[model samples]
Target: MRLKPVPVEIEKGKINVDIDLEEGKTPFIVVYCQGEAKITFLPEHGETKVVTHQGKVKRVKFDEGEDF
Candidate 1:
């Protein structure tokens, strides 16, 4: 699946993404900067996956009210 980056506001900076996924496919969110990254689902319904390009990845959970 092609992951697109949407506009996101982080603690210090902003993130922009454009993802291309097939229809019926689950929706996911990925935040990355430099080499570190974080992936979270739409809701807290599923597990979040953390991945690092060379160092470490952090998983964060957000509520629906925090979304746009």
Candidate 2:
């Protein structure tokens, strides 16, 4: 199956995607950035939901520490 990139808008730090699916059921791909991200998909209702969170740090830089 071929996946198409859908246009998204970020409002209040949340991303919303609107997709139009053809007749019959199909699967689509969803991309998310790092940090803290939440996702919700509703294929039966022909809609997908995505939520992202900020202000969270994943890694910290150390001067005398070994990088793994």
Give the clash count for model 1. 6
* Local accuracy by lDDT, each model: 0.50, 0.41
Residues 1-68, candidate 1, lDDT per residue (tens digit)? Answer: 22333556667675655444554446776767654444444643444444454564433434344334
lDDT string for model 2 (1-68, tens) is 23334444455555555655554445444554542333233254333433334743333222233345
Estimate the TM-score of every prediction: 0.29, 0.28
Runs of candidate 1 with Cα error greater than 4 angstroms are: 1-25, 44-61, 65-68
Poorest 10 consecutive residues of model 2 by lDDT? Answer: 57-66
Model 2 earns a TM-score of 0.28
CA-only RMSD, every prediction: 9.5, 14.1
